[model samples]
Target: MASPIKLHQLRAFVEVTRQGSIRAAARLLSLSQPALTKAIKELEEGLGARLFIRHRQGVQLTECGEAFFRHASLILEELRAAQEDIQQRLGNIGGRVSIGVGASVARTIMPEVITRFHRAYPHVKVRVLEGQLVSMIPELRQGELDFTINTYYHASFDNELLYEKLMEKEYRVVGRCGHPCAGARTLQELMQCDWTLPTPRGSYYKQLVDLFVSLGVMPTVSVTCETFMSSTSLLAKSDFLSILPRDVIEDPILGQQLMAFDLDLPLPRATFYLIQRKETALTPMSAHLANLFRQHCRASA
Candidate 1:
């Protein structure tokens, strides 16, 4: 009978595929190049397949390697989850929970939730990664992120992810006090003002464009900001107008710096979701943090 594949071999194979070079993988794994190479060789021999193609610059996964990578990644993730599960079951409140969140959620909800969570689970570390949803979704699937709290559109489109709506958010047109457009009562008037908008790739940006399209007016974008904070800051100190979430402007700090104007036209409501992998089980710390977020949403509502 063939010998059982070792954990180190699997680790080596996965790391090589991820790093795309044995030298880099070896450095990451804290192993010698020859040792890492031997591990990959043993893994290929055990599976009776070539996992990678060696090249001048680095290596690329073969078809079989790609197939194996998915399962290998899941296996490792499951093992880590199991370890966390066992630790929590033993009455240890220590573990790490990684999350992907957007700028608005990060600024508003996460601060309160994380504070409460940390007070409760003092030993469990929480790591928050902020990015666009397009990039963060894959991390959630790969088990790198415990969950994501952000606006999600077309919840049914991605079957691999489970999206539970946390709350519906409304946007308001905002600018510094005494701005010219602050007196504008309708969407058409606001369209005439220069705007500081979010990056075009975000859902909010699309919503902004769709809003103007529905009104048959073109928006004049003066600047495109990568984050809500930047846009808010820009709006606070300049004549540029921006559409921001009610929660964001309502926050005491921002409230002091900016003012919201009533738009005559209805704006699209954003649905914030708690997104997670369909097949992955949540660790105790992760579930608790998620509950904290839900509780925060409810309390704020």
Candidate 2:
């Protein structure tokens, strides 16, 4: 049987179609114009079809080329998927996986997750990017990161992204060990004090905001911090108050240094969710790391 057409031909075709000029495509592909022309001629001969029209203005794809372009994109994507699958199968889970996590998850949960993951698969390298929910989905879509842990809501990529509920925890009003809000009796009473809050884009923070709106009052935010660590750290040293999940307050390191105040009205309950790219298959290492994260969250609960 004749050998399959070279990937170089497909690459050349894709570049030429995108660039819209053989000379431009040749420059983009780092090939001489004549060499590129020969490659395209050979490809069209093998395929038994004309793929492009040469013009003084620029090249235009033939009807067949348009269809071919669509197939070529799918082929390249599948090739990537296959490469990742093989790497996983070979048990070479040493490649980098970029993950995004909310500030709270990074502070309260990721330490244990990372430690256990590394212990089991020391070869795999993990890079965790901490950011708000607003940026997480965009970053994931851009292929800048693999997955993230955030609150599950209506998402544009809901069909292609998996959101797994990790756990549920209640909110607590917390302040520095010496802050006065630590002794406040009710929402009305606590409202009298200054507060630190995570940005409204934060899933929990949104709930916090809605809870106040429902109560016919909006709590005044004294300061806004980007991450839980920064917000909590600020609460540790200042008289400012912040609302946090019960799990974070219950954490030994943070719990010992902060105090939770009683509130007259109940705060909204928050559910934590783990967001990941939908995968029919993943590298052996990525699957293991994901499993490790789930296992650890279960253990913590």
lDDT tens digits, residue span 45-113, model 2? 888889998899879999999888767744554465567668867865666566787776887788888
Superposition TM-score, candidate 1 onto the true structure: 0.88
Stretches of candidate 2 off by over 4 Å are: 1-82, 155-160
Q: Model 1: which residue pairs collide? A: none
CA shift at 226, candidate 2, in angstroms? 0.9
User: What does candidate 1's lDDT look like per residue over 52-89, in tens digits?
Assistant: 99998999999999998888877787788789989998
**Clash counts for all predictions:** 0, 1
Residue 285 miss distance in model 2 (angstroms): 1.4
Q: Model 2: how far is 272 from its true place, Å?
A: 1.5
Best by TM-score: 1
Which ten residues in a row are the worst by lDDT in model 1? 150-159
Per-residue error at 232 for model 1, in Å? 2.4
Clashing pairs in 2: 88-284
